[model samples]
Every structure is written in structure tokens, then in C-alpha cells.
Target: MKKILYLLLLVSIMTSCGEYNKILKSTDYEAKYEYAKNAFEKKKYTQAYTLLEELVTIFKGTDKAEESLYLLARSHYLNKDYETSGQYFTHYYTHYPKGQYTELARFYAGYGYYLNSPEAKLDQSGTYKAIDEMQRFLDYFPHSERAKEAQDVIFELQDKLVYKELLNSQLYYNLGNYMGNNYQSAVITAQNAIKEYPYSKYKEALSMIILKAKFQEASQSVYEKKADRFRDVIDEYYSFINDYPDGPNAKEAKDIFRVANKYVKE
Candidate 1:
């Protein structure tokens, strides 16, 4: 019985392959379209993409154009060619506007970029593009079933951007007074990140970096500037403690504040 089943499966595979090869060489566009749809449904994305790639252009002014274009984008997406899929999806929505697949095209275009977003330490152009596309999806489809998911992706991408900035700020802080006043640059970077993403998960970390940077800056200042610089550290320490009394860096912040306080008068 198992042998019979195996034989049947072999025959089925051979027949399917034969039919696919015939379709691949056929000149009948309608036959290619139907086979492509079936191929896509069966998860044969490469075959579907090949057929749909040609049909999308061939059927440009025909009734099948919209579906062919959308299927082409979906085929690339399913094949994990997210960058190409994103471009095709963008093309579909721009040309169709009100086509049947516009909503999905917009959603996937952004989601494709989201899927393709690189590590935080890498270049973040893709992350930025993902956020922009997802925001546009939200603007156009506020009540979509995917709206909440899109918003979540946007927040996650924003977090990645914040993380990159945090790394840059830390790098600057670590370079304190080697050649230039990097502590000040660290403070600026952290402060700007805080202002730009007030609700980021990295907000506390950024604030802590600012406080640390200010403390380091004060500690390395000239004798004539020491008192005023220490005052700045004290103020920053207060701000940090007020926001996060029990934060991970609270103890470290307190240690800096203790040293900074000796320079300030009552």
C-alpha cells in the first residue's frame, strides 16, 4: 500500500512538472496567467514570478493588469526578495490607487522594509524607510485590521533609531577630552534623542548618558570653570533622579552627584 502511494505521488510530481514546463514555453498568455495563479497558490513563487513578470507588462491596459501586478509583488514577497517586493508593491499602489489590492500592497511594502531592516549598528536607511511606509499605511488606513500592527512596527523601528543614537552618544562620551570635548557632544546627542523620542524605551538610558557626560565634562573642566560645570552636573543629576529614582544607573548617578556637590555652595 505504501509503495502504491509513493508511486502515485511520483506520477503526480512528474505530471505537474510536465505541465509547468509546457506552460513555461507556451505563447498563450491566458494559459500562463491561470497557471501562474495556481503556482502562486501552491507556493511555487519562483514560477509564479516568472510568469507574472511578463504578464504584468503584457496585460498593462487589460483587465488582468491589476491582478498580475499584485501577484507579481506577492510572488517576490513570498520568495523573500523583500527589497524588490517593496519596490513592486510601491509601484502597484502608486498606479492602482484604488485597485483591489491597494491596502495589502501598502501594508506589505512597509512590512517588507520592516522585514529587511538591518541591525541597529548598521546603516539605518531601511529602518527609516520602513517607518515612513508604515506611517503612510496608518495615515491611509487608520481603521485597517493591520493598523495596530503597523503602529507597533513604527515604534519598534523608532526604538532601533534611538538605539543607534544611544551607541553614538556612548562612543562620544567614552572619547572624553582625548582631542576635543566629546562629553559635550555626547550630552547633545543624548538630549536630542530624548527630545525626538520622549517615549522611547531608551529614554532612561539616554538621560543617564547625559547625566554621566555632564559629570565627566565637569570633572575635566579647567579650575576657573570647575564650579559652574559642577553646578550643571548637579542639576542634571537632580533631573535624572527625579525621573528614575530606582533606575539601573541610579547608583552611578548618585556617586557622580556626591562628587559634584562639593563644588557647589549652599
Candidate 2:
């Protein structure tokens, strides 16, 4: 009887062990999820992106779907696929607005756009978009822990845009007639640059461009028309003084204004 009982207990232990092994294999959801995580932990970003994407798709509608979506976005981000990562974050935010990870999604979406901003010499449309998105994040999540980081990014992007505008204006000025066939375009470009980037350090240079362009335009005018054109130069000089009362250019602008006013039309 003891032998019989011992045999039954051994069978029970063996059955339980087999069932547990089956549980390990059949519950592929966690295994797949872990596999992707392990790859990410090992810094295999590309592999992680692929595996996580697959895991999310297959596990759609499961309890872990939200987590899978978040992980998928992170995988793409870790792989430096900022455009794709941004898209996924946007998708996540739209689908799960109140999810636990919603704030993270918004932050990553804004950050992705920030990271994707083109070089300073290129068009700043993307940079402006980043700034707008980040500002929106701050406005919506004012009390969020990520608010300070978002503000910092917005400031940095704004600085980049200001710098870009200044460079463009200066380039137009340096290129002279080669940049545009007429002085009007150059003057207009410089003026617009100043208006667009009021905080830029290159305001003086922009003022100089406008002043020089107007002077040249006035000099090229014909007969009595020259006086009318010279008046435009004088007006611009005054405008410069009004905007910059104490800068290094202020005195220079005043001198130019004095000289330019003498040529004004009656």
C-alpha cells in the first residue's frame, strides 16, 4: 500500500510538471512580449522594433494592447525612426486619450517632431511645427511633470528659427543683386526678417541691410523721383531708430537719417 501511494504521488508530480511546461509554451503572449523587451534591453533596436510591431498587431484587443502600442512606439523611437515614432505616438494619443501612458505619448510626439527638425539652413516649417506641438502639450498638461521639458524644447526650437531667419536675411543682403534682381526684394526680405525674429541678435545687421538697400534704391532713382525714393530711405532710418533707441546701430541710423532727410521731396 505504501508503494502504491508513492507511485500515485510520483505520477501527480510528473503531471503537474508537464502542465506547467505547457503553460509556459501556450501562453505565447508574454513570451513574445518578453522577447521584444529582451532585444530592446540588449540595444537591438531594429530587431525590437520589428518584434514589437508584430506583437502589437497579433495581440490587438488583448488586455496588453495598450502596453504593446506604447512599446511599439518606443521601439521605433529607440531605432531613431523619429517620423514613424511620431506617427505612432500620435496614434496612441488619439486612441487612448486617458490611458496611463497618455502623457508620455504626447511628450514623445512633440519630441519626435523636435528631433526631426531639419538643419538650420533648411526650411523651418518642421521646427515651427515642433514648437507649436510642444506648446500645445504644455497648455494641455500644465501640471504634468513633462511641462518643463516641453517648455525648454519650445525655447530651443524658437531660437533655431530665429537664427535661421537671421541667416537668410544676411545671405540675401550679402548676395546683393544676385539674390534678387531688385533692391525692393532685398529690403523687403530684411525687414521681414527683423519683424519675424524680433529677439534675434542680428537685428543690427538686418537694419543695415534695409538702410543700405534703401540708399542704393534712392541713388538709382531718376530726377525729382529721386527725392521721393530718398524719403523712403529717411522713413526707414527713422523706423530703425524708433525700434532701436540705444543700440550701436542707433547712432549710425540717426546719422543716416540726417543725411537722408536732406534728399527728401518737398
Candidate 3:
């Protein structure tokens, strides 16, 4: 008897919930808009999204339509639905440029992409997109309060990009070392440092190390070799001196070249 009563009560509650859902779905714009606004104010983002989406569609040409659309985007953002939020924020910016929430929408659009960016070791599609949008914001609103914050975010993302590139170059250097063919490695490392960090105070020091490592590796092969192998070392020294004419390594490379040339040819 008690089990039968519980079953009946469960069915009745489910039917009531179904009827309430139908009523909510059939509500008019004024009803939906007020509900959405109240839900948003109370921080009920999921409920707000459902109501505002309905209100925006039903109130199409009215001023509230634009506000409803903007609120719908914000609701998704507050719910941490970043990709969906980004899409709706983009729509709001495009369709309602002069809307009251335009600047906030633009700010959040970039912020949403930034929040969605992957780890530094992963693909940086979101990072790059956020950078582009944030830069536009800074350019369009140089005096805005968010400009400095935008610039800071740009610098942080840029540093991640730089670190990733440096890691790749370092890998190449490591591969070159493992092959005991430091010549190519040294050249690649020096070129990478110049290309990626030309302003680095360490650039000259890095170039010097590449030259030294290449010369040392070749010369070690030079001294511990038979006649034919000795010739290869002498040729390398000649190449090094010709490539770096005025560096400290150039003078040493020249001296090694002359001695190798004389003995190897004899």
C-alpha cells in the first residue's frame, strides 16, 4: 500500500514539472524577458540563457532584443561556456555596435578566447586569436582603462610563443651534439639566437660558443686521425676562419688552419 502511494506521488510530481516546462516554453516576450532579467540578477545563468534566447527571438526589432542578446551571451560566459560565449559575444559586437553593452561585449570576447587558450605546449589557436582581438581593443581604445591590462596579456602570450620557439631550437642543438657533428648544430644555434632574440645580450656569447664547439670538435678529430681524416679537419678550420673573420675564434681558427694545412699536405 505504501509503495503504491509513493509511485502515484512520483508520477504526479513529474507531470507537474512537465506542465511547468511547457508553460515556460510558451511564455511571451515580456514574460520571458522579465524572467531572464531576474534570473541573471540572481546569478541563475542557465535559466537566464533559456529565457533570454527566447526573448531575443520573439522581440526581434525592439530595443530589448539587442539587450536580450547581449545578456544571453553574458549568461553563457558566466556559466563558463567559453566557446559558446565567444560566438554570442562576436554576434553581439557585430550586430549591436552602439549597444549599451558593446565595449563590455568586446572585452569579454577577447577574455573568453584567452580563457579558452590551450596550454603552452599545445596548439595556440586560442592564444593567437585572443592576442589579435586584444590588440584591436588597445588600438581602438588607447585611453580605455583596460588598455594596460590588454598589453600585459599580450606580453604574457608572446613570452609563451618565444619560449616554445626556443625549445625547438634547443632540440636541434641537442641533436647536433649527439651526432658529434657540432658544425651544423653551432650554425643553427647561432642563427636561431639571432633570428629569435636578436636583442639578447647573450647573442654574441652564444655565437662564440657555437664557433668554439665546432672548432673543438673538428680539431679533436683533426689530431686523432690518419692522413685522410686529417684533411677533413683542416678543411673545416679553413671554413670557420673564412666565416668569422674578426671574432676571437677567427684568429685561433686561422692558426689551426695553417698548422693543419701544412702537416696534412705533407
Best by lDDT: 1
TM-score, structure 1 vs. true: 0.94
Per residue, candidate 1 scores C-alpha lDDT tens digits across 69-176 of 999999999999999999999999999998899999999999999999999999999999999999999999999999999999999999999999999999999999
Could you tell me the TM-score of candidate 3? 0.64
Candidate 3 residue pairs in clash (backbone atoms < 3 Å): none
* Candidate 1 Cα deviation (angstroms), residue 213: 0.9
Q: Is candidate 2 or candidate 3 better by TM-score?
A: 2
TM agreement with the true structure for every prediction? 0.94, 0.76, 0.64
Q: Name the 10 consecutive residues with the lowest summed lDDT in model 1.
A: 257-266
RMSD of each: 1.9, 10.7, 8.9
**lDDT (tens digit, per residue) of candidate 3 on 34-120:** 867887898879878987877877888989989999999999999999889988988988998878887888888888888887776
Better of 1 and 3 by lDDT: 1
Indicate the residue-level lDDT of 204 in model 1: 96
Ranking by lDDT: 1, 2, 3
Global Cα lDDT for candidate 3: 0.72
Determine which window of 10 residues in candidate 3 has minimal summed lDDT.
Answer: 200-209
